[model samples]
Target: MVRVDRGLATTIGGAGVARVGYSGRILEAAADDPASGPCVGDWALVARWTDDRSTLEHLLPRRSCVTRAQSGGTSHAQALAANVTLAAVVVGLDQTPAITKIERLVALAWESGAQPLVLLTKADLAADAAEIAADVLTSAPGAEVMCCSCVDATGLSEVRDRLGDGTMALLGSSGAGKSSLVNALVGADVLATKEIRADGRGRHTSVRRELVVLPGGGCMIDTPGLRGVGLSGGEGIAATFADVDALAAQCRFNDCSHESEPGCAVLAAVEEGTLAVRRLESWRKLQREAAWVARRTDARLRAAELRVWKQRTKGSRGHPKRR
Candidate 1:
């Protein structure tokens, strides 16, 4: 099976296009367009073209995909990257990291079938970097947490060492220093970086997602900073809040809501101070979002099916009887 390193989408005369990187050369290819356009880190099969124009035959199966609910009122999910092995949830140390946002992103990463790594960037700016890292570790239960400063290159080696010969993706909000971290890992000024504003928000320097080869023998996809991350249906919620799920398993009722219910082990844990109330609330909020997305997706699927059925039966209903 022939495969390329990076499948980054670029624009051609206002038309969305995809490029395949192979043997240190970039090739423009035609891709079988889907409802959602090709994303970074996608694996695709390319057809050899005699003419200058190349065609993307089809997209190969994705091992994993990082997706989020489309921002606007649309009930659609957007794919950030495809076939990612590691998802680095970058958070800036200059500001107090939002644990809830981290949890949400971790859930999305888990749902993508990739290993989630909580990365604390700009560690040099924060006086209590270690303390903040510890708090983030609590929010991310089963994932590895690391702190690094791009300015001094502290902990960059460790982060590079962890990404061993697989596609990794950088995910974070604006001003989380994702671009800086990418530049540090690649050891060059390949991506642009911007200064954080007085409001502590970083400018959106990366407008599109693109893949770059790491110096140490791996590829990484850098995505634009996310302002609002909504959840789609997946096992990420259960994985992010594994502690709460474990407690829920011990509940007397299999369908226990964990709210004012009899023999509710989850509530009991919260009452006994084992599980943090804030964590429980976050889990509940994500669960609700996931459920809503699932309903909307199902409705959309049903509507599509109905349209297909109507198209198939359209002219037949009005036809005259045949002998």
Candidate 2:
């Protein structure tokens, strides 16, 4: 499925006329049909007959999925794209990149089972671009950090080289120059560009998540700017904060929260100037968010189970037993 808007699916290829599937049309086919609903970048099996236009027959198992907790007070998650191999977390150098935001996106990318790359865009706008990138590197840990200016075409080659022969997805807040980067990499104006607001935030130019084939033999998915990204379940936090994990290992207490606890290696590191207090605070905040999301997901699952049980036993108490 190339795009899914509302309940209508925009399908390309296969056979027959491209048919549009209405809301609940695909799910009505089978009880488990909803489980296989298409997301952006999903390789799905579709019925090509003229009568079955827009209906997805099945969604192939995803090797990886880029997901985050659904916004708005919901415990459910929203999958941004599926089967992405490279997740480029873009940040704008025009302003100081938020370490906490980068950490959260990197964790989400890691949790999605994709390799995360940190891209600092608008290199031409920042005099201290290198220093800002170096600071972000501490948050990204194992990920490679690259600075690129779409205007001057600096570091674009490195970005393309790193994306070699894999599906790469550009993710960042609005106004981070993700679309500009996509246009640069594609060598054409495939996506639109807009000016950053006076407040230094980006306008939401790309409203939908769509995939585009790159000139370099790889495909990419450009997503709209995200304001809030919540964590689902994954080891991304630990992976992003591996240094803290290592420090925690040496703490005298196994249950060290790294806050004012005695013999806390993490705190000790902060005191000794080995670790940045801001970094530790960001890690702790993300951990708490992840934990809260996990609890919410578990509660949702249990509630679903209880509902199923209630439905199954609705009239059993008054029914006669069959011999």
Candidate 1 C-alpha lDDT tens digits along 1-323 = 11222443332212335343331122322221131445677655554456644445455677888988877787777778888889889998888898999999999899889999899998998889889888888788897899999888888888888887887888999889988888888889998888888887788998877787787588888888988888886599998888899999999999999999999999999999999999999999999988989998889788868976776677468853331
lDDT of predicted model 2: 0.82
**lDDT (0-100) at residue 257 of candidate 2?**
79
Off by over 4 Å in 1: 1-36, 315-323
Top candidate, metric lDDT: 2
Residue 42, candidate 2: C-alpha displacement in angstroms: 0.7
Against the true structure, what is each candidate's TM-score?
A: 0.87, 0.90
Candidate 2, poorest ten consecutive residues by summed lDDT: 28-37
How does each model score on lDDT? 0.79, 0.82
Badly placed stretches (over 4 Å) of model 2 are 12-36, 51-54, 315-323
Give the Cα-based TM-score of candidate 2 against the true structure: 0.90
* Candidate 2 residue lDDT tens string, 1-323: 55667666666564632545644544553233232456777876765556544456766789998887888876767778888998889998887777888998998888888898899999999988888888888888998789999999999898888888888888899899988998999999999989988987777889998777787487788999987888887599999999999999999999987777899999999999999999898888888888898999899888978976776686587864431
